[model samples]
Target: MPKAELGSTYWNNRYISGKTGWDLGEASPAIVAYFASQRNKDAKILIPGCGNAHEAEALIQLGFTNITLIDISEELVSTLQSRFAKNDSIHVELGDFFEFSGTFDVVIEQTFFCAIDPALRSKYVHKMHQLLNKGGKIVGLMFNREFPDGPPFGGTQKEYKTLFSGKFNTKMDECKRSISARLGSELWVQFDKI
Candidate 1:
């Protein structure tokens, strides 16, 4: 976990200073592939801590109809709301994700998990449970490695499995389709609220 609480102000400054190394500029291919396989175009999907939201863009491209994006950074969400203003299929809101509320059939986890303070991992698990409908699942990529210091606090599958154990039906596999640079370090994670 970070010595300082990784909060709205900290994240806002990251974007302002252009320190967003986590902004992939495009959707993670593995995640996009998963979206491509989803048959329901109208599934209610939420992307928390959504940065730049390339995955949301991909979801729109793939014909998804209801996508919600929430983030703590006002600067980023303002730009996002403006960016998607004309699109009814995507909704952008500026707020702390932990306090944000909505129920969804699917939650997309891109780099968001790694970006949170590790000490809040269990809180994250509880929040996700509350946000999802029964049988609804969270699917996307997570780091399978560790970072020296981070907003991108990394973790191994063992930790994740333990964290989610009683609350979800979890499945994780080494992500086979991660973009070249991230391929080896990523895991494809799916956790259905149990």
Candidate 2:
């Protein structure tokens, strides 16, 4: 597919057709554990490329008060807006993450990074830095292996470190608690904006 074709329309159609293989049906275990470990429940958090937003639900249940979710897919965002309409703590926006601006204490990364083309990796890192407050963190998983074809583009720790280390302090480890399908293949990353 052409790079341009991978924009909002491609993703919206995925949602429209229920082609979301990336939806884990619930919040990712590694992410949930990280959130559970946080002492502050009111930290400002952002979840970009937030399809289905299972993490938002987890955050709400954990007493988190400020959360933002963004997705390029109109269909997905519309559904999420309605799904979260009655909740005052969560804000859902339909837009591109690179263009969306907000300062967050924590940004949750699930399958979002891998969903983008690999060539945009540097842009993704820069945007994450822009979206964070000083000492803010990005906590979640990244695929540790490669895929033959990808919407699920994968990368190694070396690449991730090289991409994020200049702008952030980075730590990565095998995620033992990953959901079965991703077990052993997922790397839990903590990238702190310096």
Candidate 3:
């Protein structure tokens, strides 16, 4: 399918139809470990394409004060709005990641980068750079392999390095704490905006 076809309607339908095979139903262990090591509980953090927002919940538990979540699916965002209504620390918005505007100390990437069309990878990098404050970092997992064709599109570390080189400084390695299904296939990346 063309990249434009994978917009909000497509994603909302996926959520409505229960086709979200990518939903892990809980926070990712690697991300959780990274958050636990952080001393700053008040960092302004953004999680774009934040489906179900498991990481946001994990952040709340860790005492994070300013968490923002944006997703293309209105259905998912509605649910998130309701879910986080009582928590002032978390903000939920329905919008495209590329169009959303914000500056954050940290951006948590999970399956978001893979969910976009491969053609948009460069745009994704730029948007990430724009969303982060100076010295801000993007931290999380990216698939270290390929898919047939996907919302869970996969990529290699070499490609990722080249893609991000001009915009950020990166540290990537095999993720030791990935869930069993993704173990050895996930790369834990920390990209600091330059």
* Best candidate (score: lDDT): 3
Off by over 4 Å in 3: none
Alpha-carbon lDDT of model 2:
0.92
Question: Each prediction's TM-score against the native?
Answer: 0.97, 0.98, 0.98
Model 3 agreement with the true structure over 11-84: per-residue lDDT tens digits: 99999999999989999999999999999999999999999999999999988999999999999999999999
In candidate 1, what are the lDDT values of residues 1-194, reduced to their tens digit?
46366888899999899999888889988888998988999999999999999999999999999999999999999999999999999999999778988999999998888888887889999999999998899999989999987768788999999999899999999999988888799999999899
List ranges where model 1 is wrong by over 4 Å.
1-4
lDDT of 2 by residue, 77-102 (tens): 99999999999999999999989988
Residue 115 displacement in candidate 1 (angstroms) = 1.0
TM-score of 3: 0.98
Report clash pairs, candidate 3.
none
lDDT of 3: 0.93
